[model samples]
Target: MAELANCPRCHALFVKGPAIVCNDCVKREEEDFQLVYSFVRKKENRTAAILDIVRETGVEEYKIREFVKSKRLHPAQFPALSYGCERCGAEIREGRLCESCTVSIRSGVQKQGELDDLEARNKKEGLGPVTYYTVNDDNR
Candidate 1:
């Protein structure tokens, strides 16, 4: 069943199903996509960067980035097309984050897992009472 909701772009009420925006916003988005697609498909504009395309076509940078992120624009054909990392503002052609951010996040998770394992081991070993030991200086 479709739920009634307000369109994100124009704040108009519409049935929300597969699309978040209303029909009008969808049509506008389609037009923008066509404009961007047509511009990028031209032989002379094939090598143009996202900024160049935006400047030439008067399209918003975020719109172009969205196209690239959604796979609407082929990164191989448009080598300069890239999006900012979600964690860091680094240029990346694929995925939500750059390689460095990915590694950092993975390392952090590994460290957390190791800490949890250590805590589990300590608990399993019975963390009950504390004991202290003393050595007599005369023994030396």
Candidate 2:
């Protein structure tokens, strides 16, 4: 079932289906993709970076990045094509984050798990919050 919604790109009302944007925007994007694909398919432009492709093809950087993210443009064939990490703005060929950010997040999760285990052990052992008292010389 298609629902009426405004297109994200052109703000035109259209039936929403598998695509997020309206038909007009989709057509425009297809044209842009063709322009970019033609430029990158060239032997001399095979090694061109995203900026170079944008400059030569007159295509938006985000559009090219979107193609790379969607796997329409493969980085294996064009080594210079890549997208930024979701967490950090580091250039990455695949996945949401770069290797460094993934490792850091994994390490943090492991450390949190260890802390939770230790807390559970302390609770099971009947250990509550620690209390400290200072002696009063007058009372002593």
TM match of model 2 to true structure: 0.89
- Superpose all Cα atoms of candidate 2 onto the true structure and report the RMSD in Å to 1 decimal: 4.2
Instruction: State the lDDT of candidate 1 residue by residue for 17-79, as single tens digits.
Output: 899899998898888889989998988888899889988888899989999999899799988
Q: Give the whole-model CA lDDT for all candidates, comma-separated.
A: 0.89, 0.94
Question: Any runs in candidate 2 off by more than 4 Å, and if so which?
Answer: 129-140
lDDT (10s digit) by residue, model 2, range 1-140: 77999998889999999999999999999999999999999999999999999999899999999999999999999999999999988999998999999999999999999989888998999997557998889976
**In candidate 2, how many Å is residue 138 off?**
22
Worst lDDT run of 10 residues, candidate 2, spans: 127-136
Best candidate, lDDT: 2
